[model samples]
Target: MAKILKSTDLECFQQQGYVRIPEAFSPVDALAMQDFIWDKLEEKCSILRSEPNTWDKHVTGLNKSAENTIYSDIASQRMCRAIDDLLGEGTWEIPKKWGSFLVSFPQKLNHNWTVPTNHCNGIPWHWDG
Candidate 1:
């Protein structure tokens, strides 16, 4: 059965770029997913040590993991459902640009290292330009 998102959920998603769907996954499920990703990272490490050329060829290790990971179950189901509700079914087939989910680990900075200035890439200016 498909879970119906409430009006509040829609409003929150509209105002903010994203919204947190509470209790979307059980604690056990979330932990399992974390373990799954960690296992993939370990596999990547092992592969890289055995075959350094493979690592160089593929910058992101996600492709290997994506194939092994079960999208039908776990976290992906919730994301797919939300996307369907917001964009309508089969919207994924449409050619969209600049949409991705990224996860990064924060690194501790040394005394000698200073914070670097970063800028957001602006959208293409049509009328002004």
Candidate 2:
């Protein structure tokens, strides 16, 4: 059964350009997904889960072409329902209609880096739709 959205969900999406569903995915499920992504990354990029030093970029999952909708076979039901409720029934499609799986692995291990504070407040060109 699809989970119905509260009025606040709609309001938040309208105001913030995004809606966050709490407790939609369990921590165990999330870890499983991360494991799945890691497997794919290792398969495609040869980056082993034990070796974090090999993980150069943030991306770990496949780019997922628009022509293929096979990923639906693996998508979580909760996610599909949430997207459908938020966007509309049958609105959730593959990369062509919806979007790709952007699995980003955060690099948190101790490293010499500094957050850049000086910046011109503007949309990054990559996101300048």
> Best candidate per lDDT, number?
2
Query: What's the TM for model 1?
Result: 0.52
Model 2, 1-129: lDDT tens per residue? Answer: 646567888887777677776655677766665676677778787778898777765663375542344344345566667777887878758343434457555677686875555546753323111
Q: How many residue pairs clash in each candidate?
A: 0, 0
Residue 118, candidate 2: Cα error in Å is 12
Model 1, 1-129: lDDT tens digits are: 475467788887787656666665667776776666555655655333344343433234554455444432444566557667777777675222222213344344466764345434754322110
Question: Scored by CA lDDT, what does every candidate get?
Answer: 0.53, 0.63
Q: Where does candidate 2 have its weakest 10-residue lDDT segment?
A: 120-129
Backbone clashes in model 1, listed as residue pairs = none
Q: Where is model 2 more than 4 Å wrong at Cα?
A: 1-3, 22-32, 58-61, 65-70, 73-77, 89-99, 105-129
